[model samples]
Target: MQKEYTVTVYTEDRIGITNRITIIFTRRGINITSLTTAETEIPGVYKFIITVMSTREKLDKVVGQIEKLIEIHRAFVHEEDEVVYQELALYKISTKSLESGDIERLIRDHQARILTITADYFVIEKTGHQQELTDFIKKLEPYGLIEYSKSGRVAIVKWSRRFHEHLKELQASSEA
Candidate 1:
């Protein structure tokens, strides 16, 4: 059975690494639902959080191919329960909508924050799971949603001790 999986990849920060990683999915015809990449706690190392819907068997093979890349330190495929994650979404609504006081109530109810208010529009920010963000958007549409965007997932594995130890070992080896 096919289910959603989050593939986390750790790699050296180098040009073309993103392209190389995406190409692996492209060749296998796996569609990426979302992809987020950013530097890690370890300097010169970066992490990629990719969401896709695929079978565990196929995902394992994909992770193996990703690990074969020279720049990649490690790659992992995690079920949803194996990690903690969040995504950020921003909504821009007309300033006029704020007059009703309902907008403030909505923000407070959803635990969202008003990022900025201006003559023309106000921006609201929410950080949560994908469903929560989308539900917030639905509620905001009636209040004059001018625009909205959501980021890819950012996640930390539940059991990351092994990865951190691996990084420490690499640092030690490099210093020798």
Candidate 2:
């Protein structure tokens, strides 16, 4: 089954860096579900968080391609359960379709903020995983959807050093 994979790329901050990364996806005939890039803590360095849907083999090939890029310093693929992740979603829903009290309860339950409100519609902002946001959409569907937007997954290793240690142990056990 095709599953979502989060790819993190660490690279030099230079012109066309984004284009170079996107080209890899394009060449592989993969579509990026979501992408976010920013400067890293270190000067002259940048980080990109890209979410894509593919099989395990495709994911591995994509990582290899990313690492081969001249500007990319490192590239890693993270399984959903192995990483800490979050997504920001903004949705405009029809207020007329829901009871005020029910809508208020949903807003509080999802920890969403109301950004704007019209007589018929209200914009709600939420932050969580893809599943959480998807569930929220289903619940609010009764209220009618006007528009929706979601930011890509931003993730980091949960037990960063532990992961490295586990790899080392596995290698040692295999070689013995």
Highest lDDT scorer: 1
Whole-model Cα lDDT of every candidate shown, in order: 0.94, 0.82
- Candidate 1 lowest-lDDT run of ten: 163-172
- lDDT (tens digit, per residue) of candidate 2 on 42-145: 55557789989887788789889889988887788888887888899999998785565678787897799899888888899999988899889888787788
Residue 82 lDDT, candidate 2, scale 0-100? 74
lDDT of 1: 0.94
lDDT of 1 at 27: 88
Q: Which stretches of candidate 2 lie over 4 Å from their true place?
A: 94-99, 118-121, 159-176
lDDT (Cα, 0-100) at 125 in candidate 1: 93
Leading candidate by TM-score: 1
| Per-residue lDDT value at 53 in model 2 | 88
Model 2 global lDDT (CA atoms, 0 to 1): 0.82
